[model samples]
Target: MYKLYVRPGACSKAINVLLRDLDQKVEVIDARNLEGFKSISPTGAVPAMIDEQGNVFVEGVAIILHLLEKHNSAMLPKELLKKTDFIRWLTFANATMHPAYSRLFFLNSVVKDEAEKANTMKAAAAKVSEYWQIVEDKLNKQRYMGGDQINIVDVWLAVYAGWNAYFPVEVTIGPKAKAMIADVQAMPSFKAATESEKF
Candidate 1:
């Protein structure tokens, strides 16, 4: 009974996957038309959600956490070290990885000149590569970002990895990362949300 505002291939995919994984029924509104969302969330972001009780939720991390805590799901563990590690990857993906990709995707919006846009894109690609190196290293160590399970962090990770396709930056998922992506994709709900959006 949640209404999710989403545009195909946005980080809204994070909430899509979460809802699917939780087997929760939700109303998905295309964010290309934000009339429903703007009234709730000022930013009118795609990942915004309207809960069953009519309260609104926004942002990838906040929404993901809301579903986890509200549903008492194990995607985010209750332990100390695992929770910290889970939060570490989630923050790294959102705070660090997302910015570089957003810049690369919107380089033209920021830089007016064609020449400057090209230079800026190259610089943005480099930053994304640097961030990917960090991610690749971490995935090389574990089966999933949030620990052994393919949780919200893992779903968002797959979402971003696929989203990188929109930019010139290419992120080659390591073996373990590939496994996680494959696992998520294998889900009927995940495939329904993502298969058409793949680049």
Candidate 2:
């Protein structure tokens, strides 16, 4: 069995969804309540895992790729080109899009001056919207980021979309992107993860 540590509503939610979707027997631990969490994940990040063999894994994308490949999940493409596309969109979501939202979170908590916070947060929100446009454009080509079927990237972006409620900024997600998120959220894995986290 796998042991997964997660913070409610964090990117860890994606990992939770992935574990369930893969039908992996996992024990979910809320990192917020766990003492000495940094000992497991030195960076104190959620979405960290301890595998059956007792090997520890940290970082969301790394853990996700490891599980998908290890389990030989159909969600991961077997073809060379399709696999490349999978990695591309995964990076776009984790590396590109996630940081854009991180900026908003940082500004909200760190900026003491209200006017400065608003200005910086506005800029960050614009950048987030820009990324959403890229997502919208991609979805215009297909039903989901992974083509006809939903993929982990879709789950990741849907989890990130939940953060919009935390900030006062208006991040404009397009209609297509919105629909995609809705679909991802409707999945049993996503619903189970959300409910487990009490979100």
Candidate 3:
């Protein structure tokens, strides 16, 4: 059995959805109450996983990949080129888009000075908008980030996009993004993971 340490509605939602989608039997632990989360993850981030063997892994992208690899799901294309593209989009969402929004949302936390925080929020909002435009373009062309079928990349991106409702970011994907997210949420697996957890 694997134990997943997560904070509700955090980036960990992606991992939870994926695990349910794969139908894997893993214990879910709320990191908010779980002591030593920082000891497990120096950054004290949510969505950390500990295997039955006691090996621990942290980070949303890493955990998603680990679950996909462990399940040996056909959803993850085995071809090198396809896999590379999957990785590319995953990295873009995790490293680029996620951080950009973080900066925008946490402007005050990131910057001490009031004027600097306002400036940072302004710049970060533009960058976040640009990134969403890129996402909108890709999603408009393909049903999922990995083309037709839902894959790890799509799940990961959806998790970040889910935050749009909570945070004020101009998401131009419009109806398409909403529909795509609806499609994923409609999945039985996704429902199972999110039914008890607030998203």
- The stretch of ten residues in a row with the least summed lDDT in candidate 2 is 190-199
Could you tell me how far off, in angstroms, the CA of residue 62 lies in candidate 1 after the best superposition?
1.2
Clashes of each: 0, 0, 0
Per-residue CA lDDT of model 3 for 1-199, tens digit only, reads: 7777777777777887787778777677777756777999889988788887898898877877877888898876799998888888889988998887677668645577877766666676777778877877888898877888877666666677767665433545556656677788777877776664652
Model 1, 1-199: lDDT tens per residue?
8888788888888888788778898777777865555777787766888888888888888888789889989877799897887778788878888887788878846678888877777787778777777766777877767656677777776777776666544545566667888887677777877753453
Q: What are the RMSDs of all candidates, in order? A: 2.6, 1.2, 2.6
- The CA lDDT of each predicted structure is 0.76, 0.92, 0.75
For candidate 3, the 10 contiguous residues with the lowest summed lDDT are 166-175
lDDT-better candidate, 1 vs 2: 2
Per-model TM-score on C-alpha atoms: 0.88, 0.96, 0.86
Any idea how many clashes model 3 has? 0
Report lDDT (Cα) of residue 72, candidate 3. 91
Candidate 3: residue 182 lDDT (0-100): 75
Error of 3 at 109 (Å): 5.1
Whose lDDT is higher: candidate 2's or candidate 3's?
2
Q: Give the candidate number with the greatest TM-score.
A: 2
What digit string (tens of lDDT, one per residue) describes model 2 on residues 1-199?
8999988899999999999999988888889967899999998878899999999999887998899999999888899999998999999998999999999999999999999999999999999999999999999999999988998999999999999999988999999999999999999999988888873
